[model samples]
Target chain A: MTIAMTTSPEALTACCTPTGEPAMSEETASSLAAQFKAIADPNRLRMVSIISSSENAEACVCDITEPLNLGQSTVSHHLKILVDAGVLTREKRGVWAYYSLVPGALDSLAGALTGRS
Target chain B: MTIAMTTSPEALTACCTPTGEPAMSEETASSLAAQFKAIADPNRLRMVSIISSSENAEACVCDITEPLNLGQSTVSHHLKILVDAGVLTREKRGVWAYYSLVPGALDSLAGALTGRS
Candidate 1:
């Protein structure tokens, strides 16, 4: 909330000379922020754990509720956040929905953090 | 807020067995969640990028405020969160506090996410 109006990127680069160069463009920063925020909650982390470790690396909402003891609706909300953030993918099969990790998404994010992306 | 009371780990393991085994224990999940929460903001991500990309991989609060267009106090607050989460280490140099990444912290976190930890 304390984010003030940004000066141009050029202005920024000109002003800050303590480094060889700036990295992490504003666009990339915003993108990774959304991705990290998607999985920052305890329940969400637990969900990812359970699913990633589950059979076929996929899980149903019913399976999700037990470990975290969360309601289906609440779990759905968290899952939606992950899906929206591109962390997990959701597929509907009959009445139940299954969630799985988007391939290489987490690894790609990890690479970004280590500046190896 | 959706996090409910956890069942014993054994009960959880017994109930959800669609896989060879469980991964990412509650304690690890909680710890990683806190760490992810610490860097989930755009400004915070930008700060990390700035510092990691900077000279000697260290930066002062004064340098942080300009690029992110944030106030020094607000930047300090974010820095404290990263420091508290063990993402960054702070050093006092005269009147200024210098912040640098904890070596391998980001990589270790990345490895944990990819199950390479």
Candidate 2:
């Protein structure tokens, strides 16, 4: 339910302020960049899309790898990067790891870029 | 006011559908990834932030570099990437090159990720 990014508290706080308000501090830009970087790969982008579209807006590694035709390790790798970026949350249920979008994470990122904040 | 990404029409069409709708084809994912890759760097994100927050929601390279403490060449490099990705529009006003967000570009990207479509 709760996912945390590796970005520092200060950077995270500064990451999604509406554009044109002020120049972002270097730390803030770097933090935001990291989030973008996580989804910059085609495989990762597809993984996010697949998980987001799943029932209950969540999917396990098993579900993702099949549709993506990617190996489990590869899917897991992408999932880890997303989780580290705070874009996705990982929950362990029995032998499976289920990934879900962190509420508002993408919205805030989008809001930051689109001046929607 | 019109900015074009290097992404093909098919990819563009596929880029912004709601995430839960279906798995993105490889081309769509790649196109979306290219857009994300353009903004994946700290400097680029700041450049976008600076431009988005400016008067009329636009900024020139000169205006952007000064605030970021970067050189003209460095700033230009980042701008070109954004333009190529179709995230920003480049306009030549006399000798200065002005950059503005491509209308709805960020919104579409955000919509894809956040299920806002």
Candidate 3:
């Protein structure tokens, strides 16, 4: 695989270049597509939404699962997808993995979709 | 089969309600997921980016294929996905199908991803 994301700011530096307007490059298209694919799943989308609007804008896997009315494993699986997509970052405190929105992840994605800087 | 989309304004009316940050509901998650799914494909993503940045914000299938170096059938398939995702609106003028970005489609998607109004 080409790895999940660019993993560096330099990757996206050209993303917003060309000013005013430009066609999305192949790299940009693939990168943004991967991120969007992460949110493309209903389960992952639900999890990210819950986490984004949660208290402190972070949520433990346990807290996220209950309202979802889904099995623990399924929720975890979905969480993995969001984390892979770079939309959510995971921090393990003790036995729990707490997920929080990666700062600017949504804005970057929104920018990509809107062709904004 | 719940049809591809909600197909009603009432469906998305609740999309932006519950302001000041709130957990995304199941309906909201699914609807947004469906739209995201449309942009999830690499081919489709390339096509949308090309078409979105094209002259007049619209492009015929013929105009889209050459730059991407992809075959006509592949481009058409990608276009179908974007159309199904509600990102591109199609207008058949003579023997060609012309596609234009839906006025608020990108904004609506950006709003959903950003949780913005």
- Which has the greatest lDDT? 1
| Backbone steric clashes in candidate 1, count | 0
Itemize residue pairs with steric clashes in candidate 1: none
lDDT (tens digit, per residue) of candidate 2 on A36-78: 9999999998888887777778887767877788888988988
lDDT of 1 by residue, A9-114 (tens): 5444443455646656789888998899998888888888888888788987878886677888999999999999999999975456789999989888888788
User: On a 0 to 1 TM-score scale, where does candidate 1 land against the true structure?
Assistant: 0.81
Candidate 2 chain B weakest lDDT stretch, 10 residues: B10-19
For B1-117, candidate 1 gives per-residue lDDT tens digits of 654333545534443445545545688888998999998888889889889988788987877887678898899999999999999999975456789999989988888778787
By TM-score, the best candidate is 1
Which portions of model 3 miss their true places by more than 4 Å? A1-22, B1-22
Q: After aligning candidate 1 to the native by TM-score, how far in Å is the CA of B113 from where it should be?
A: 1.4
Candidate 2 residue-wise lDDT at B35: 95
Query: In order, what are the TM-scores of chain A for the candidates?
Result: 0.82, 0.79, 0.78
lDDT of 1 at B74: 95
Candidate 3: true interface contacts recovered: 0.49
Provide the global lDDT of candidate 1 against the true structure. Answer: 0.82
Candidate that beats the other on TM-score, 1 or 3, i.e. the better one: 1
